[model samples]
Target: VRLRHALEVRSPTFDTQQFYDLAEKYGCAIVYAEDDEAPEWPKIDLETADFRYARLMSSKPDEPTGMTSAELDAIAKQTQAWAKRGDVFAYFIAGAKVRNPAAAQALIAKLA
Candidate 1:
């Protein structure tokens, strides 16, 4: 039996080689989160696994979609880079519960 696991970390304290080594040992994908609550790890140049995972939990308070065109473009480029080597699973989760789908769609368009 084979099960794939992805870890969503939310603190800067987890940003260490030890944590990455642990994830690699377990064959887990380290999630790159883009929420104010989670420290921005993807902003740094780090790759623990060929496959990548990302969860965008919130947009700016003023932006209902939680992302602007520029933001989505940048994320698309990042995801494209990951996709070049392997697979990338990205989600736009609007913590406010209103624009998640739209944000995701916009990102998808950018990726397309």
Candidate 2:
């Protein structure tokens, strides 16, 4: 399982380490997400789990592929690192939803 959009995880009183420990124990992974609305959310390290789940929510409507080529490349690079360890699941789920397919294709091209 993958947990997403749980803002409480970022709360000061939240026991992050314990949460991770529990997640690991149950074979669950936290979604590593990027959101314009929640920029303060901490980034989840790729090493936290055996598999990765990333939600790319910073796509732009003006960009041809929902995101700039450079952004796609950067994501591909990071994905490569994650793939080296285990399975990688990435989704372009927000911002310019119409261009999500193109963004996904561009990322696949980069990964290729």
Candidate 3:
């Protein structure tokens, strides 16, 4: 956790098992395909990455943050580096860590 914090990463991604474990423990949402339909590697463009991010964000608006190519590349590098560490978690909390129930209700509405 500290390592990710130091690197300014909120999410800690791990293998499938560890990912689920972390999500369960943290009461965060889990996003995955049981059939191992993982996203392809060496993402061709932000659109591709956006698709994955949209899945994580509940497939609402897959907006690209307009980060520079270098900045996005850095993020990809870091994500890959974290993956190399192996045995991590992909727990996600609210973007702002807000405790309001409204966010949950909003998501429920979206999914419904």
Candidate 4:
């Protein structure tokens, strides 16, 4: 079986070109995530891996779907842009437990 690995850099110190270089050298994909507790990417670029992976973690605690239309739109745009370059796997998991499915569907609709 082939080996596939992903790196989720949670600290700003690791969000550097050198980190990406190491990831690329090891054929590891960098995980792009949106979370209140995690450091976001300094820049959204797709030069580190052949594929893309993202964890959509930015959602207000009170928002039913955890995300608003504007947020979904922004994510859609980014996902589309990344898709043009290669495959993108995004998960909407950082929101209300009951709303994640609906949020994901809404985001899918936006992407569609």
lDDT of 1 by residue, 30-67 (tens): 88777666545443335677678887775765775568
Ranking by TM-score: 4, 2, 1, 3
- lDDT: which is higher, 1 or 2? 2
Best by lDDT: 2
**Candidate 2, poorest ten consecutive residues by summed lDDT:** 4-13
Q: Give the TM-score of candidate 2.
A: 0.81
Model 3 TM-score (2 dp): 0.23
The sequence of per-residue lDDT tens digits that candidate 2 reaches over residues 70-99 is: 889999999999899888888998868998
C-alpha lDDT values of all predictions: 0.75, 0.77, 0.30, 0.76
Looking at model 1, residue 32 earns an lDDT score of 78
Cα misplacement distance, residue 59 of candidate 4 (Å): 2.2
- TM-score for each of the candidates: 0.81, 0.81, 0.23, 0.83
Show model 1 residue runs off by greater than 4 Å: 37-45, 61-64
Judging by lDDT, tell me the better candidate of 3 and 4. 4
lDDT of 4 by residue, 6-94 (tens): 67766678877788788999878888877765545543454477778888777666776678898889889988898887778888776
Model 4: which ten-residue window has the lowest total lDDT? Answer: 38-47
TM-score of 4: 0.83
